[model samples]
Target: MRKTIALFVLTLVICSCVSATPIAVAEGEADRFESWNETDFLKDFVSNNLDRTVATAGEEKAGDYVLSVLEKMGYTTRKDNGLTSAKQRFDYVDSINGDANVGYNIVARKDVSGATEFVIIGCHYDNLTSYELNGEKVGGEGAGEATGVAVMLKLAYDLRYETLPFNVVFVAFGGNQLGLYGAEKFIGANQSIVDNTLLMLNLDSVGVGDYLYMYADEVSTKHEDFVYDLSEKLNLDVRKPPKDKKIVAAKIRDDSKLPYHHKGLLSENSLFLDYGVNTLNLFGYNWTGEGYGGESENHPDIVGTKRDTLSNYLAYYSESGQKKMETATALVKAAVTAEDFSAVMKESKKEKFDYSWLVSDKVRIGVSLGILAVLAAAAALVYVKLDKIQKNSKKAEDKSDDFQKQSEKVFEDF
Candidate 1:
């Protein structure tokens, strides 16, 4: 029975495998997400705000920038002395250099289902800070860091409209370049909450708008396969993570217990592994992690540095491909698939399903089976009837002949 079910699942998988081209429907078909565009609200948001990512830790303006975006997306805002809202909160990491210095983590979630499963997707919004040097603010802004924030914004906006498989918390963390302070605080305060999380995807930098990069291990292949497969179908430039980084996951090894932040640590992200969730953490880079999922539209050298500027974040990065936008969309679609966005769409919007072709293939397969079965049954029945008729006819002929012979012999004798 299990084998039969597995075969059926395999058949369904083949039938549902995402195609190179989006499915074509007759006129007036419901819009299936062929190209899941990530440029909805966040792109606009990030393009405008990349400069602020380099602001000092606990910068009110930087925190507010993220806050405004969340509020626009319909989330209630909360603020504490060391916190802002559920989405934006404060933390002090002394090791990273701070008193009760302020840093914010903006968090928000869409309540799709009960908290049976929880997936946390996050990115650091704070970039490398500008330290005062020689009475002048030395080059402010971390290289590659602003791009990370921009990508996070884009992701946050994308998730706002998406129907998620589980309750997805979008966290905008601060202080990654500075000893992972922001991430540590968030994870530490919410260790139990983090533990309950099913999956976590950390998008550090997503789009130079050229190619896609995925970071994962063998355990993440199921999720990674979806991305790679989609990339193949789209013929896009999709790259993999470096060898050392691949082993990193949702939990890590510590003195006694596995720390939250290790190659396999839930310290910050990779929550997706808990619930079999798939995820990726992209960073802005030049040649290696170039393009959309690799590097955002930011200069890699200035990332995690104060020298980072808006110019560092806005140039459209393109490699030889279809139009940059088209390629970017393709990569986004692939990530969404690996992220299980399609499932969310299908399950959440079940009412919108197209009933026309819902069972068309099944009906067609059934028709073929039915026709062959009927033909075989008819052939067998016909052969049996013909055989019986032939035998009966021979018996009658033999009996009649015998009678005639006997009668003739008796007449002759008499």
Candidate 2:
């Protein structure tokens, strides 16, 4: 009985000692990134083609890659493009209207509108494989920008059939290495999508080992705040700068029609404002963009070199990176589905900050249970011994009475 009590106590103690943690659910996009293994792809891209120094063929390769994934995700080849001259009708239109061959904005559209709106998750996959100084490759080719394509494809494949509030369009913009041209092409052609787009997240130089720097034009103050708050609550190390006085002022006086929900410059001065959407830009190296400095300045010169490969992170598994992506995706899911950014932020903060006092509470419960069990068992044993003694004593007394009765009978007979 003591042994049973001890065993029960031990089990209770163990149960109290450990508590489960929440696991990650990519929802539907497992292939979007194989997490740590992504470094292998980065290494492969850097070793084979560190040539994003030029701005032409790099974007085409990236664009085609996006198209392939979109096709895999059930999006047909884009036939009606409004920005690129390739789809035009006349020589005049092609000449006066346009002049280059790199590639067009690659966007895949799924017909099913799970939500009334659309969310365009874009990534600038173009690279300067060879930088041209006046139509010639300058210095040398650079590390091609392919990871954006790789990551975007991963998302495309993952979200293909998964239920979502908004249908997603994966975009690979060319001319990013040149001057955000590919991104510009996409925004220009899909202007309507901009207004209707719930949010725009662009992945650049991702899939490598580096601090993921998230950026936003003047149109993303509140959204940025939401992201930062979410990240902090989760204890993630992401690069999101608080808007300085200047940035806030810029967002206020901007003169564009697009409504800036973010608490930045209210004026629509930049193209980001035209869409009424938020842009999350990723700078792979040097962190020249806003709210991105520190070690980023000391990192590799990813803008022009092929050094920005998966191997950049081969030595270390980046928990920080995964947390960033997961958090961002969760944020998008919340804002789009709930139509409430504040609500999502609050909820995520609660979840991220919440701790189950499981370890402590369980310990107390276990100890209490063990003590009670031990006491109860000891009482039962004592009761059993007492009952035995009482029974034995009763039997002896009855024997004595029987003997006495026998003697009295003998006397009476005599």
Candidate 3:
């Protein structure tokens, strides 16, 4: 009886711990995050009926919305005009018109006097074409990545007035669904800006999932620590991929883990990765390690569909989820505001070069040939060994047959 009572007490304790609410930071530089209105801004921002298609009215309106928010925050905003050729290269052109279809990257800058290095925080505001399970064309909507756009807006607002150790640029990419065209263009044209950037944080699908995920790489330890610190404070679940595992956005269903290929950049962060930029991707939803059962925007069927609206997300996740998003926003803010973040990113001046030609065809061809040669050598050795074994076995069988025949004849004579 005493043991049973003790077990019950332990269960209650664990439940209480799990149910505990996250409190705002009472002291320190990150305390401004406590005042952030996470959902109010997000709901209004995402509510805009922006279709995510490249070069469409919805895309333009969405870009305008991002610019409006940044301008309200008192940041210098501009439409980067250099990515027109990049849009052409990606084949994001209209069928009716022969002109190259392109979307502008709304770049908002917060310059710090005497600070040479800058940080880039970006997400795609454009939506994708919705399709049915049978691959039939259906009506498209702006619900999928609206949450990500909201997150960027909130970040701009939260950090607008604060002076930091480095300059900051908040960029909303236009042609993400059309193969990361916006990001590709930004990288191509702004080689100088890209060089000065210390880190790039990409937010996507922030409105769903039970756990916060930080897709990290070798140079993003400071970013990882910031998210982890937030997790500890809020008692929120957080996950990072193991070193050997690929840094990817993945989907997890009941008992199964599948990789989510975003079609462009494979994942939005890959654009920066291809350029060897320091990057960290923050999103809600895990379905990666140990498998999170909580569903969020990472759901393949839900995101980029008409169903990914504000009402649906709120109803599906409940008010607590919004609160969680607030916490997530706070954590990201903390990371951005951390004093030591800029110190780790010092680098020599970067020369202007087209990253499109960064990887030569000859190098790719050489690597492919090397792999093919190794595979061919392995196959040949395996075939030779198998052939020798088969020949030896056949010889042994023939010898046995001869002996049997000789024995049979001997027995007949006897």
Candidate 4:
């Protein structure tokens, strides 16, 4: 009996040691993410839901589809009826005959054990109903809009079971086309969530553009840098807006007075910046265009136009669109599941100095003119001083000649 008891104690000790061994850290590396096949889903989504204009049946159907997708993935879903009380504040609401209940933001949350911080993944699902462009009433094709939501959904599906250091919240905002009403409402309602959020990644127009770019507010520079580095590791082509173009664009919009304008895009991401939250906006826009804005004539003509149809997008930019979606998904996955997310969160809170003014044409032109004026004045002063010296030297030479003649006359007279 004594021998049996000793053996049982030894077995217990061995089991405890084995169980106490720490598991390997969860590093959301590039190798872990493979190429995602979302082409079928993207094509189908855009085909079925073509006109997702705000306060319309099409928009409601799109919202329901998003909720169903999340529910099918075993996620508990909820709705935040954004800014119900202040419906009168928006002029578009009246124009569209939209009431307080028009835009409802669909929210799905995944909680991690013992996690204090949260990461928000958001995108708007609404597009223009029908707008007259070039004397033709065109349906809203919404290829870019569909692509943004598709990437968000794909991320949710991919990261559903992963062990992340922070909780994840996915939001599909409504009434975005109607002036960012849904995003504003969500921000107002979820103050606590916004307060503790480590990063809010906003995906907008990730398809049918010439480039895949990322933008972040000034406070979230670390997050931007980290994601850009990760993209390089993944062999993805992710870029930021050109410094000179962004400066010119910001100057045209008169965004100089806004403190965080340089760091952010004019999208739903701007709403989060208002609450001092770190935000990264993954957007596909044509920065190679000679025109100033993303939607200039030189850029791809999609988003709110007839050509935004999936068929058109696929016909023209199918390969580039797929690559953009894949890059966005991989980068977001790597970022959210990063082992050093806590460190990133801490670093992202520290705001960086804004250097946008350095590249601004207004500032550049002013400094250039100032420099030329100074140079011209210096040249004039130098020329005047040299002229005075030359005149004095000539006078001195004449006096020397006169003295030599006087000495010669005195010697001859002696």
Candidate 5:
């Protein structure tokens, strides 16, 4: 009886310890970002074949690679060659249009279920004149501009199986280094898409710095507050300069300021901003110059140099890549799940409950105790049954021994 009780207690203790462990759910969704490795594609983008220069054979190779990937992922891809129209509309398009070879804008479109609107995400794939360590202009292929392309490709792969509420269009703009010609051409050709675009998120050079910078001019959509709120929700160190200030293009020595209402002065998101489409230009580098009361060197230098290869920036790639992935994930989640930016930002302000804590020690202990009680009762029932069987077996053994002795005594008397 004492042994049965001890065995029952031991069973209860074993069951209690097992119950306290975290439960694994077989139906949980897999993480999409984990499978999307940025460096593997980055290597291909920076290879010698995809030289990414203006009107070069290498540029065509890069465009072909992008198109192939989009097709493999089951996206409807198209090319936008609006440079002829760009030349007719703007006087500044003369320099870039000199080359008879047309610059192609690779666009991949995916329609979401019940989506009434479209979200255009873009990045420039063209690289400017490569510079040396001493700031000397050199003639070579460019890899600095490839980072944005790599990021966009990763986003497309991660969101391939996702069903969002808004149509998503991923664009790789050519001739971006010449000017914002590719963006201008896209806007010129896709008038209908521009009109219904819910937001335009531009990814440019997101491989360098620790900080994530989002730029919007005065004419851009009123998305500063929403972006700030979203960044806080995702825990990204974001820097968004004021509209009245000039910081975005100061390091590059361009007129990429907020009051860029002029067609000649354009960033990648210029036309979208001009047409009142909500635009967010996500860059990892921050420029600190006279406009922001500091020197340009105070900020981390941007790509566009020969040294801006994958090997050079590979050290911090994981950190910057994680931030970009998190930002994209949060933005897409909010866009797909929310009715408007206001609702998204408002929800970010609410106190979010961490359901992960449910499996922590405190809750686990309570659950373990309940499970232990039930297991103890079951163990007690099992012990009583086994104890009765043992006693009955002993009684049967004694009866057999007595029968054998009686038979032997009868045989001896005979």
Candidate 6:
């Protein structure tokens, strides 16, 4: 019995000390994007489009291209036109027309048998009409957004045949430049999906930046840390938002007291974070630089400008951009395919209770004034009652004294 108890204790210790092993990727896995002709696809996709502004012909063409690619990959593909099967509309107001417009969110899915959860990978394919930078107007080619779409496509194609533990859904969101309309529509139409989502990985502007940055919802950092660890293993230079005054000021300025608002960059991931979903956003930007530019030498701030063309990206920063994409794909692939993904997800799933109402200055001030008013009323009522009692007691004592004096006077008269 003593030996058995000792052995049981030893087993418990071993179990307690042993951590879950994350998925491992071979070094060559990072190069799969190049090997599988995904880089060529990226170049072609970006080159063929002038700009994918929402509600335009270019946007429609881009959406069609995404659908065709997914269909060829042997996956189930559909277009979510910001509408629910129940006929509910999740459309957004067009900035130009001021009319309701449906942003086509291209959704492609690969299902695994017995999988109850989903891993969503998303990217915005829309670009701004134009951006005025340094007093010069420039057209928006949106190379960064295109890069994200290409990365998502590569991931979809690579994972097409694999039997993942969870269902993988790839989304190319539309009208992201105007607003996060596409992402919002997706969440609104798929309430059930929101509940079953394990993780939402967002790739935005992941190439052509100075450095690769990873941002996660404030609810938990486990997913972010896991990807960061993967980056380290792969010898990729991945960074988190620095705690600098500029970054902090930006966060504060954009603070809506929402989960995603606390993060540095805002994208379609914001909507997912708002829904309390565990989201990982991989963006390529230099947090240390001004105006979304990278800190690296010659890293131009070309994201929203005409200079964001594929040619410029290739000519200046192709090597670094490709490396960043490779790193992002490898890290994301490893994370979603990790052997202990469920375990990691369980740890990352934290209930992010919004206490903003309780912490709001308006609510606090209102509540404080309400309590003060109640206390003041109670104090005044108590004071009035005490004063009445004191006066009544004094009157009774005076009456007693008068009665005694009258009785003494009557006795003297007698």
TM-score of 5: 0.60
Tens digits of lDDT, candidate 3, 30-135: 3333454666556656665535455676666667666655544555323222111111122244222334565677777777667777788888777654423357
Using TM-score as the measure, the top candidate is 6
Candidate 4: tens digits of C-alpha lDDT, residues 138-179: 555687667888898788778777877777888888767645
Give a tens-digit lDDT track for model 6, residues 82-201: 111111123566443355565577777776667788888998887754433366655567775578888898888777766677777788887676556677677767767778898899
Q: State the lDDT of candidate 5 residue by residue for 1-414, as single tens digits.
A: 000000000010100101111112123212433565655556656663335664555555566567656555555323221110011111122242343344667777776555566778888776644422256654233443466677787777666666566677888887566555567667766767777776787777665554556775443233556666766876766677534444233211122223223211234776565555667776654344434322123333336555455555664455565565456545545544455654542343232222344445787698899899999999999999999999999999999999999999999999
Cα lDDT for residue 98, model 3? 36
Instruction: Evaluate residue 288 in candidate 2 and report its C-alpha lDDT on the 0 to 100 scale.
Output: 38
TM-score of candidate 2 versus the correct structure, residues matched by position: 0.52
32-137 in candidate 1: lDDT tens per residue?
Answer: 1223233323343345444443235334455566656555445443321112125334445333233344456666665564544555667766543444435655
What's the true lDDT of residue 141 in model 1? 38
Q: Pairing residues by index, what is the TM-score of model 1? A: 0.53
Model 1 steric clash total: 47
Provide the lDDT at 83 for model 4: 9
Per-model TM-score on C-alpha atoms? 0.53, 0.52, 0.70, 0.67, 0.60, 0.71
TM-score of 3: 0.70
What does each candidate score in C-alpha RMSD? Answer: 22.3, 25.7, 14.7, 17.8, 27.4, 17.1
- Local distance difference test scores for all models: 0.45, 0.44, 0.57, 0.65, 0.54, 0.66
Per-residue lDDT value at 158 in model 2: 47
lDDT of 2 at 95: 21
